[model samples]
Target: MTSLSKGDKAPEFHGLNQNNETISLETFKGKKIILYFYPKDNTPGCTAESCNLNDNYQAWLAKGYEVVGVSPDSVASHKKFADKFQFGFNLIADTEKEILQAYGVWGEKSMYGKKYMGVMRTTFVINESGIIEDIFEKVDTKNHTDQIIKALDIK
Candidate 1:
């Protein structure tokens, strides 16, 4: 649902991570960023996606990429989720949905004919300069890391 596309400047944002520490796009300046947005914490699909990424986090770091996840869940929720899974990356708590809206990932969604506003699952591969190198709208939750590597053609 995001209007942002590849080659666009990724929107700047600042929010509290699961630890309640402030995290901002500025914090990752000059580093390739894997910025991902998800709907909630502790859900099946979200858990699978997050675990897959966390499982391969070291490989991502070795490749010079930092992973960050954003969700509308509260800081407490994020903390629990991250702690339970022992995630090695920052999980930003977008409780106010500010980051979500800025990235255009917050929008109306439907489930079983019921429509509601929620965060749309998305990932933006940002370059060292903060430019979006690729956008993944249709994520493969169980194999997201491999999906990203293949999509970016990373060797």
Candidate 2:
């Protein structure tokens, strides 16, 4: 779980996308950002969440929000996943977990009674001024985009 809260300054982050292109928070300066962190690539929940965003990509863009997903997956894995889903936005390959840690989404999680350290699913809605407007900790995978729309009050 992230210590960050609404109205907090979003942590600066830079990482490579599936295409090996550098992407940073600076890259989206003056634009609203939906930075979502997932555990891995090609998982059921992750896929549903990403696909929901893809389905509403244009709506988000029209509302001036740039959506991006992050995961601790390799560039190659991200490439495959994005290609398979034909996502319209960037998927940052956080192989080093630097961005994940900076966002405070890298932490311990329990699954099936087993506790382990991993990336917790999280989303940060950052305004054009680079301050967090909302944070989504309990994401609804298939309706994730709807959740964002509600959170940001985007018409």
Candidate 3:
């Protein structure tokens, strides 16, 4: 799969959120979207990343941005995770791997000599006009909010 680049146009996607509400990329037009894809829900890295974003979510909105987390987990799983963590944003359930494949965030991952297919902890910042403004592939979930804020040029 071709890795998504800085200028690559983010693929369009229509999926259900934790509430089972159908959402499409078009619905978020004219807004800054922080699209972060993680491997799973409730896991250490994923939890830390989501919590950090939740912790600093106001800063992002003040800069005219919205966040939409995506993962291969089911909507129920996403709901439990979000409810448990008190997240303030939508979690797109990409269980079919459609969005994951299109974004190139889903692929082979290695852990202790075992290879498995999963999300790569990649994030893309899409501008209001739908162009990808930046990408952070080397995500450190513990300090991800700072990284995203810096990438978006927010003070």
Candidate 4:
């Protein structure tokens, strides 16, 4: 679990998006950010979560929020995934796990009696000034937007 909590200063990060464009916290300095970290690209849970956010892209934008995804997947994989889903948001390719480590989302995991290091699916809702407003450690993949909206009481 992440040591980060609401009201803490969000860690600054910079990574390449699917388009290979450099993006950083500074890029969205004046906007609320929904920063999500997932395990991989094209996986079932990740896909569902990503698509849910994509489907509500317009609503998020209208609500003054920007969605960004981060995964250990490479830039090429992110490009393919985003292109296939036609996502309007940015998917950061954190191939080096720099951003993941900064957010404390990259860590050990156990599945089927096997232990491995991987991403812990998590989301951070950061306010305009780079303060974390909410942290979602247990995400509802298929209905994530609703989860965030309900948690934040967004009208």
Rank ordering of all candidates by lDDT, starting from the highest: 4, 1, 2, 3
Residue 24, candidate 1: C-alpha displacement in angstroms? 0.3
The TM-score between candidate 4 and the true structure equals 0.99
Any idea how many clashes model 4 has? 0
| TM-score, per-candidate, Cα-based | 0.99, 0.98, 0.95, 0.99
Quote the positional error of residue 138 for candidate 1 in Å. 0.3
Residue range 17-115, candidate 4, lDDT tens digits: 999999999999999999999999999999999999999999999999999999999999999999999999999999889999999999999999999
Candidate closest to the true structure, highest lDDT:
4
Which structure is stronger by TM-score: 3 or 4?
4
Model 1, 25-91: lDDT tens per residue? Answer: 9999999999999999999999999999999999999999999999999999999999999999999
| Each model's backbone clash number | 0, 0, 0, 0
lDDT of 3: 0.89
User: lDDT (CA) for every model shown?
Assistant: 0.97, 0.92, 0.89, 0.97
* TM-score between candidate 3 and the true structure: 0.95
Give the clashing pairs for model 2.
Answer: none
Superior candidate under lDDT, 1 versus 2: 1
Give candidate 1's total backbone clashes: 0
Candidate 1: segments with Cα more than 4 A from true spot? none
